[model samples]
Target chain A: MPVLYASLLTLFLILIPGIGIGLFNMKALFGIVVLYGAFLIFISGVIYRVIIWAKSPVPFSIPTVCGQAKSLPWIRQNKIESPHTSWGVIKRMLLEVLFFRSLLRNEKGRLKTGGRLLFYRNLLLWFGGVLFHWSLFIIIIRHLRLFLEPVPSFVEFIYGLDGLFELFTPPLLITDLLILLGIIYLFFRRLFDPQTRYISISTDYFPLMLIFAIVITGLLIRHVQKVDIMGIKAFLIGLFSFNPSLPKESNTIFYIHLFLVATLLSYLPFSKLIHMAGVFFSPTRNLKNSSRMERHINPWDYPVLVHTYEEWEDEFRAAMKDVGLPVEKEN
Target chain B: MVYDKGKVITGLVVFLIILLSPLWYNALSGKVEPSLKLSMPKEEKSCIEERMFMRSNHMDLLIKWRDDAVRKGIRTYKGLDGKVYRISLTGTCLSCHIDKAGFCDRCHGYSGVKTPKCWDCHNIPKEEGSKV
Candidate 1:
């Protein structure tokens, strides 16, 4: 089914550019048009999505509380989980963005043989998520060396730290291995977990397969394909500066890597991959749990015309008096 | 069940427009084609490496040369054609590619690539007058 279709679609995406640039020599198309197009789409689409999310009104203070809220002076409050102020919310967001604190607390439940419930910390998901994100960040930072002309000191420092082991000729980067392992763990988790498998759709599997293909192509370029690094830097620098160029004898693997990256960038806005940007605008994560202290009036709420009890009484007074009923005002 | 179809459709339309903005811009502006230029040396018949290899890998070769000359004190580079070249920017490369502006900046300027480090230690030839 869906998984098969997703896998095939992902394979086709990888192959189209892989073959186009590698075999048909459509390097110029992939290098210039695809790269620039993807970048523009990525930037504009993200901004559009973020703006749309921002425009949507949050009518209530719905911050998810995982720990004790601010109550009595003597009672301790969990500022990170159940924030009461803007500063507390900032801290909570920092923890959520950096460490995925909420995900870290995820638990799995099972029914025991004696009909008792059992709960266990699901550390594997958290570990894989953290590893994937951090490694991806490090890899992106390391790639700055190619885009930048002078090769910034921070990028060099990260690159040095990543290749400190010096295991092989080109020196194996730890993040490379970590990202691959992380993606593998995540993919397998989705497949093995019955609950996850039941809920998973083609979209879920497509990104995983796409990312796997991207990472594999990248690895192949670094180790197996033997691409000209200087050429890549030149091409990238040129690209960023608006004067684009492709090396005459560019490696096919490089084109594959670039195409996959382009595909990911373009697909980001439409797909669930936009959770990266959506997380910040999420009402549950961004809002402070301060409904107890401060009243939240919905900005969209309108003043309504209503018949008050006093008005009702006045209107009915004449009719009541006519019928000889007791009225409050005996004018 | 009570869904704002109009709002949802508007959002979808906006999303689609944003996603297709690049393609639209490209079609309208006619800036899709990319032009690349590399400077050709006047006197030198062959570089230390092949023309195609040099075009793509000149920066790497230069970096390796810089490290070897500055750190290891090895100034000679054995070419693929069994020729030993004395690896110095001013003494070797600039000798035949006399005008930095005409030879180097032509391609670098077209590519919008800035290499400030090359001139940090070595003085730019006064004849060219620092176009970069």
Candidate 2:
């Protein structure tokens, strides 16, 4: 019930901006103010989150170790899993960030009818996650052509590579299909799995639905509804260079796509989407597992007033003497 | 399990400031909104395409013109309005839009878009009454 309401709310949020820009011809407002504002929020939000994470003092080396720690020279150590040095930490972080090594190792627990609990590798989730992230990255890079003039050769190279399949007039990009497939798989996984559905919140489903909408609208513009590419480039170039201009005959689908993108940008920092930045500041990933070799003290630890035994003795001296108790000094 | 109130507040404050920087900066500086510097063509009331279509899709038309003229040895285009035009940048486009600086450079310069490679193989026309 909460999920349905949240999904509808998210849909409404995207639809309003999209319809406003598309139908009302509010391209100038959506293109310039909304887009730039979203970018500002994304940048500032990421920086703020990182700063907060950095300021928090980790009083313990709490790296989540999945393998053997570095010890005796003869014994094998998993440097990538149980990092003991900064370099090892960097290597581990690269693998985790780039390949999602941890997620790749994820296992789904299932109880058999005979009362036996078994764990099986869940490769579908890992594949979907990797596919979605990588495709999104490539798509973003490909979009650089719109923002930049005389589009860079590398961008052209990537664009060519993406459309190498060449199934149509404007050749189909493999990443586009992969991203769509990945998002669908993830969305279904959340909806179908009882355990996942039980733990899932509105925030979790909203982004998926939002991204799905974005991609669908984008595909509509590219294939079905053919927008003015020159106009889009001109508008985007003007927007970035601070001299924004709305092109004549703006396509509704293009505006819809742009509005959704803007919404995603603005909502990223406040939502769990900030895991993109949070991953770098995570203690479990960033910290080295060297607590056995070195001690970590809390920097914020302060001295407190303590009632010493000597002070207690002094305060009770008279009473002790009256009672004729044995004393160290005749105070 | 102690929460750092100071860190949290500072983070929120920084986030707000950064997010609102563009608005505040623009307001304080009193910067005027920028406009594209599109110049009117001399001796031509209309282009090969509709005015609105030309504004947004001139590049596509130009690219098609270039490819047709160079690769297919076709130099004429039958426009949407049923008017045929010779596909030559220097011969057709620059002939009307004589002042490249005032006409082409206007929006391109304002938007920081790079000039097309049309000039690589052709001579740039001099301004009227100016010796090359």
Best by TM-score: 1
- Give the top-scoring candidate (DockQ): 2
Model 2 per-residue lDDT tens digits across residues B1-132: 324556455756775674454344445544323434466775789888887767555766777887799899998988777988888888888888877787777555433344656667766678554432
Model 1 TM-score is 0.74
**Per-model TM-score on C-alpha atoms:** 0.74, 0.72
DockQ of each: 0.06, 0.08
| Docking quality level of the chain pair in candidate 2 | incorrect
Stretches of model 1 off by over 4 angstroms after superposition: A324-331, B1-132
- Positional deviation of B16 in candidate 1, in angstroms? 20
Give per-residue CA lDDT, model 2, range A221-241, as digits (tens): 776666656566666656655
Q: Mind giving the per-residue lDDT tens digits that candidate 1 earns over A1-331?
A: 6689889998898789878976799878998999899988887788678667767877888988888999999999987789899899889888888998888888999999999999999888989999999999899877766655455567777887898786643567899999989999998888899999999988988998898898888888776655656566656756765677765546887888888999999999889999987887788987789899999878678999999867887989889888988877665
